[model samples]
Target: MTDILDSTAAGTTRGAVSSLFPATIGRFEAPEDRALIDGLSRWVEQHFREQLGQRPSCHVYVETLPAEIVALIDRLRDSPVIRELIVRQVPAGSGFEPMKHTDELYISHYNKDRGGDQGLFDRHYDGNLRFLSSSMVVRALIYLQSDASYKVVFGDSRVEKAFTTYDFGLLDFHRELHWVEGNYTPGGPQRILLKCNYLVTAPGAGARGRFALAANTAVFYVVKAAMEYSKSPRTPAQKAVGHLCNLFRRLNIVHPLVPLAAIAASAIGVAVLAYVVVTP
Candidate 1:
C-alpha cells in the first residue's frame, strides 16, 4: 500500500524550494523484509533491555543495517529529487563530499510498559551533534512496526497521520518540528521504527567555508549548553543534540517566529563577518 502522493517517482520534477513545504512529492509503501526487521527490532529491544531493564521507552544504535534495508535506502538516497530536496535547499556545508555514509543508525522502540521514547507527548526534531562541520543532518524514517494508535504530527495546522508499517517518511531534520502522538498507552503493544541519518557537505568556499563551519558549530554548542540545562532532563552527550528548539519557549519567542529569528540572526552574523573581512 505505497501511499504515493503523485505520479512523481525518481523522475519527478524538482519543485521550487519556496513552494515545496506541505507538498507531498512522494508517499508510498515500499517492499520491506518484515522478518528481518522483526529480528533486528527484537535484537535492539533486548540490547536496551539488558542495559536499561524494562523501561517505558528505550532505543539502540547501530552502524549498519541488514543488507536488504541498506540497499533500499541507498536507492532512495540516489533519487535526484530527494537529493535536491534535502541537500540543496538547506544550510549544508559546501565542501565535503555529498552522501558520506556515517556509522549511525537509530532504532527506536516504544511499548506500553517498556521501551524508550523521550518526547512522546511533545513535538520535537531529530538530529545528531556534529563538531566543526556545517553538514546538513538529514534523516529518512522507515517504519518497521507502528501501532494504529500512533501518528507523526507535523505541518502548520498540526496535521496528524498514522504511520503504517513499511511506510517511509522524509523530513528536514534541522528545520521541521515533528513528534510522535499516542504514546499515553502504558501497556499497549510494542512499536519500532528505523532511522537513517545521513550527512551532506556543502561545497566548501575555501577559508570562508572553513571559518563558517567552525563558527556555526561553536555557536550551536554554546547556545545549546546555555539553553539545554534549563529545561528537561538531558540525554547522553553523544545523543544530546541539545534540544535547542526548546529554548524558544524559555526565551519567550512565539513558536512560529523561532525559525524566522534563527534565519535573521544567521544573516546578520554573516553580513557582519563579511564586512569585517572585506573592510581591510
Candidate 2:
C-alpha cells in the first residue's frame, strides 16, 4: 500500500497553491486491487487466531474497498493542509496523543490472558497502544474486533482519566492514558460494521460503537500532523473550498463514499501547505 508515493492518480483535479485543501480526509484513492483487501482480511484473521489465539470475535476488511480508501489518506500525508490545518489550527504540539511515537505497534490477544488480564474480552479494542501513539502527524487506526460481543467507547481524555475500561492496570507498556470505553457483544454475534473511509476521529463524532468492532475490526486512516488545534484566517478561495466541503458533508458525500469530498479535501490540504510555503 505504501508503494504508491508522491505520485498523483489519474482523475485528481489539479489547482495552483492557493486553491486546495491540505490532504485527503474521507477515503483512499482508486484503482486498488481487491485481492489486497482479501490478503489483509486473511492477515487479520491469522493475526488474531495466532496472536490472540482465543479468537475474541472481530471483523475483517478486504483490500478493494478500504485499500483504495486509505490511498487517498496516504496522499494527504504529504500535503500542505497538514501545516495549515494542524500547525496553525492548534498549539505547536498540543494536539499530539502520545506526544511522540515509534513506528507500528503490535499486540497479541493471547497475551490478554497470559498477560494476567484474562487475555480476552468482548468489549473495547486492541488499538489502545496505537491510539496513544497518534501524537505524531495524524493517525488512522483500524479496529478488527471479533464481530461478536464488543463495543468501542470514546470519551474525552480528561473524562477517561477518572474511570478505566480495558483494565490497563495489568499493562506494562507506557502509562499515558487515552479516553475510550468498551462493552460486550449481546447482538448474538454476526454483528459487524466496516468504516471504509472518513478520517480525523476527533471528539463529538461519538464516544460509542457506531464503528464495527470485530476480529478484523481495524481502524484505518492517515495523519500528517503533530501540532495542537488552532483557529486561522481563511482566504476567499479557502473559504469557498470550506463552504463547498460543508455542502458535500451535509449531503453525506465524503469520499471513498463521495469521490468529490476526497478530491476537494486533498487538494485543499495541499493548497494550504503551498500557501504557507510561499507566503512567509
Candidate 3:
C-alpha cells in the first residue's frame, strides 16, 4: 500500500487514500475476465437505453439485475477484505439490514456535457446525511470506464486520488467527505460507475441508530401508502393530497415535522372555528 502525505494550508499532513480510507482491501489489480467486464458494460448501456428508456445521464437503481451481474456482486461482496469490513461495521454480527445481501445496487452515468444530475460530480461525500445519525455505510465503486484525471477527494485537508477502468474502490461513505474533482462538459467524455452499497443495520445499542431505523421505516411505508392512495379512486382534493405526498417522498423530505405541521395547521383551524362560533 502506497501512503503519500501532503501538507495542507493548515500545515497539517493529509494522508493518501490509504490513510483515510479504513481498508485498502487489495492492491490495484486488473480483473482476470475482460470478457465479463465488457459484457457487464454492454448490459448496463442496453438496460438503461433500450429497456428502461432512460438516457445514460440518469442514475438508475437496478431492481432486477442480470444473473451474471448478481454473481459479480456476490464475488465482490464475498471478498475477504469486504467480509472483514462488514464484521467491523456491525461488530455484533447478529444485526443486519432488512436485505440479507445488499442494501441497494445502483449505477450512475455522468457526461461532461449533460446538465442533469451533475451535482453528483460536485465536492461532497456519499451518505453524508444518513451518516450524520450513526448510520455507517460502505459503498463499493466499480468503474467500467473512467478518467484518470478525475479523482475522489478525501479528508478535511482534501487529498485526491484518480481512478481508472476496472478499478475498484471501497469507501467508508459515512465517515469521509469525498467527491469527484473535475468537470464533465457536454460533448466531452463520460464516466460510468457501478456502485453497490452495503448498509449497516442501525446498531442495536444506540437510540440514534434505532431512531434512524424507525424514521426510515416510517418514511418508507408512508411513501408506499401514498403511491397506493394515488392509484386508488378518490375525490379530486384527496387525489391532490396524495400526489403532494408522493412528491414529498420523491424529494426525500418527509420527516416527523411534516405530520406535525399538518397537526398544527388542523389545530389552528379548529381553534379559529370555535372562536367564530362563540363570538356569533
Candidate 4:
C-alpha cells in the first residue's frame, strides 16, 4: 500500500501561520484510498454501535487498533513532510524533535444523531502537557469520511474549515481555541477522526523539559480519573467532582493558569483531608 505522503492527490497542501501565536495550523487532502477509508468507516460504525451506542465519542487506544490502522498511523507519525512542517513552525534557532513514543493517539468517532448540539464539542484548547508551552505540542486529525460538520478554530481570528474523506489537518495544541460545528442535521453522517499528538522539545530546555514530561505523565493518571468521574459519576461527591473538572475544562480557555489554580486547590483539599485523618 502507498504511504499517505505518496498519494497522487491533485490538491495542493498548505499551512497557515496563526497571527497571534507562534504556531501553525493547516489542512491537506489525504491520499485517495477507497478501501482504507471504507475499512475505517466500518470499524467506526461497528465499534461505536457495540461499545458506545449513542454516546457522542470514545477513544480507542493505538495498541488495540487493527494492524492496517496502526501501520497507517506509524507512517503518518514518521513522515518527513510532517516533520518539516512542524519544524517550520518552531522559532528560529530552537530545536525541533518529535518524540518517538506517544500515549495520546486514538480514533475518535462522532456517532450519528438527530441534530441539536448533542454530539458537538465546545470551544476548548486541545489538552496537552499543562506545564509545556503551547508551541511544543502538535495535534493531527485525519478524517475517514465526508461530513457536513466544520472544525472552527479561533486564534487571533475566527476561521472555519471543512474536512472531507481522507482530509488531514494539523493543530497547535493549547494555542488554538477550536471546536466542531454544523453536525446538527437529523440522521447526519457519522464522523470518524483519527487523532494523534506529538511532543516537541528544544535541546536547550534540557532537564526542565524532562521534568515537565515526567510530571505530566504522572498527572495523566489524575486526568484519567477525572474522565471516569465525568463519564459515570455514581455518587453525589463524585458528581460534584465531575462538575468541578468540567468547569476547569471550560475555564482553561480563558487562561491556562485557571486550570492550574483549580488543580492546586484540589491538591490542597486532599492534603488537608489526609492530615486530619492522620493527626492525633
Q: Model 4: per-residue lDDT, tens digit, 27-61?
A: 43345344555676777677667653444345555
Q: State residue 17's C-alpha deviation in candidate 2, in Å.
A: 24
Q: What does the lDDT read for residue 122 in candidate 3?
A: 45
User: Which regions in candidate 4 have their CA more than 4 angstroms from the true location?
Assistant: 1-35, 46-49, 92-120, 128-135, 215-221, 232-238, 273-280
Point out the worst 10-residue segment of candidate 2 by lDDT. 222-231
Q: What's the count of clashing pairs in each model shown?
A: 18, 69, 5, 0
lDDT of each: 0.45, 0.28, 0.47, 0.54
- In what order do the candidates fall by lDDT, top score first? 4, 3, 1, 2
Give the better candidate number (3 or 4) by lDDT: 4
Per-residue lDDT for 153-248 in model 3, tens only? 665444556776666666765455555666554433345666655444432435654554465545434543443344332467656755464333
State the displacement of the C-alpha of residue 127, model 1, in Å, after optimal TM-score superposition: 5.6
Stretches off by above 4 angstroms in model 1 are 1-32, 45-53, 64-120, 127-136, 156-159, 200-280
* Deviating ranges (above 4 Å) for candidate 3: 1-35, 49-56, 84-116, 128-134, 156-159, 185-190, 201-280
Per-residue lDDT tens digits of candidate 1, residues 1-280?
1011222322333332222223122333333445555655566456555533444233333325557656544554454444554443433233322222332344334432211234444555433232224444455565655567777776533556777665556664444566666644556545666554444343444554445445434544454344334323345542343343344322322343455477589789999999999997
> How would you encode candidate 2's per-residue C-alpha lDDT over 157-265 as one tens digit per residue?
2222111111111110111122223443233222121322212222222322123121012222211010001001135554454344333333331122343356688
Ranking 1 against 2 by TM-score, winner = 1
Clashes of 1: 18
The candidate scoring highest on TM-score is 4
TM-score of each: 0.50, 0.27, 0.53, 0.70
